[model samples]
Target: MAVLPIVITGEPVLHTPAAPVTTIDDDLRSLVDDMFETMEAAPGVGLAAPQVGVGLRVFVYGWIDDDDVEHRGVAINPELWLSPLSTAPLHEMAESEGCLSVPGERYPLRRAHRVILRATDLEGEPYEVAAEGWLARIFQHEYDHLDGVLYVDRLDHTNAKTAAKAVKRAGWGTPGLSWMPGVDDLEG
Candidate 1:
């Protein structure tokens, strides 16, 4: 499998909702493989099809839980259900989130702490998984990409201002974004 170049935030594909995977065939399988490879090379815990310039409803995630359990899988045409976000203050619930598309930048954003993900696997088998904590955060972040929403879009006004300043300073506010060779190093 090859590592595909990840699209940056300004790319049109990153802003458009991804198309569903109509057929589960060899090409789909190959794309999944490449996505996994790319995620690994970038060292990101999760990645979506749109990030790789493939407008299909698919994403892959790999992460080690607090208990040291390794979890990895693919979600195709996934539907995400989030638990009620914490009633805590935004600053309390919001945590720093980063994205591969908007590399080298991070900002605080609030997200659900629990999620139920329903989707088909690479082989077209349906499955459901309940995730909490960081895993749930990953699901939400990647899910946003499927809908053309980036983590920055979820930032509160104060943080959004900060994030915007950073984006401009990095010269990433233009029509094209640069790809970072490694995975995002910021917390999510």
Candidate 2:
């Protein structure tokens, strides 16, 4: 697997919802491997298919520890299952999030503290994962990217303005950042 270039924000492909993978052929297998490679190279906890200019409902995420080092692996064609059985009600767990596509821009986003998801492996075997803490949040964030949503879209005004300035300073506009008020900074 090779590390592929990430498609920045504002790119037409990034704004469009990705297509579902109907077949688990060699090409799809190769793409999934490449996504993991790219994600590892980016040193991010997760990566999505659209970030690599592939419009597929696919993403990979893993847990990161205190040293800012990520634990590696891949999750393909992720299908989130918000458990309705928990009477405790999942609360917000805010964490600073970054993306392979957006590069250096980092912002905070609030996500569920726990989640259950059903996804297929690269081999097309069915697998179900129940994740909590950081892993759960990372999955949600990266999965959103498959649908053309960025972490910045979940930010508030103050953080959004700051993020905008960061994007402008970095010479990236909409193609590198998404603007929305009050949805992206609970954890920063």
Candidate 3:
């Protein structure tokens, strides 16, 4: 597997909803492998296909829980069920979120406290995960990419303005985006 270049914001693919995976063939498996390598190389907790210029409903996640246990997997054509936003913890409201597509930025955005994610693995076998806290947040963030939504789009008015300025200063927001090498060096 090889680490793929991460697509930045301003790319049309990042704003368009991803297509569903029709078959779990070897190519799909290879893509998943590449995604995992890319995510790990970028050293991000999660990544979506759209972030890599692939318009397919696929994502990879690698995170360590509070218990220090590692949890990693791939989700293809995933469906997420979120708890009401009202139930999110008060502390989470102050937490900042970032994305691979929108590099070097983090904004505070309210999200659900829990999520039930259903998707198939590389082999087309179905799986489900019940996540909460940071894990849930990661799932929600990546899931948004499947629908062409970015974390910046969820920011409040003040933070949105701040993000806009930063994005503009970074020379992003154009129709095209640049790719960055070294996953661990990514700011998102």
User: lDDT scores for all predictions?
Assistant: 0.86, 0.70, 0.85
Worst 10 residues of 2 by lDDT: 179-188
Write the candidate numbers in order of decreasing lDDT: 1, 3, 2
Which runs of model 2 end up more than 4 angstroms from their true locations?
Answer: 64-73, 83-94, 174-188
Q: Specify the highest-TM-score model's number.
A: 3
Query: Which TM-score value belongs to model 1?
Result: 0.92
Give the TM-scores of the predictions, in the order they appear.
Answer: 0.92, 0.78, 0.92
Tens digits of per-residue lDDT for model 2 on 1-188?
A: 78777766667667788888888889987887887776666666787888787888888766667778664556667788653333452333346767656666777666677887778877778888787767777778877887888888777677778877776776665554432212233113
Candidate 1 lowest-lDDT run of ten = 179-188
Question: 1-188, model 1: which lDDT tens digit per residue?
Answer: 78888877788888899999999999999999999998888778999999998888999999998799998999999999999888776663347778988876777777899999999997789999999988999999999999999999888888889888877777775555556455444323
Candidate 1: stretches off by over 4 Å = 91-94, 180-188
For candidate 1, the per-residue lDDT at 110 reads 79
Clashing pairs in 1: 42-183
Pairwise lDDT winner, candidates 1 and 2: 1
The Cα error of candidate 2 at residue 9, in Å, is: 1.6
Where is model 3 poorest over a 10-residue stretch in terms of lDDT?
Answer: 86-95
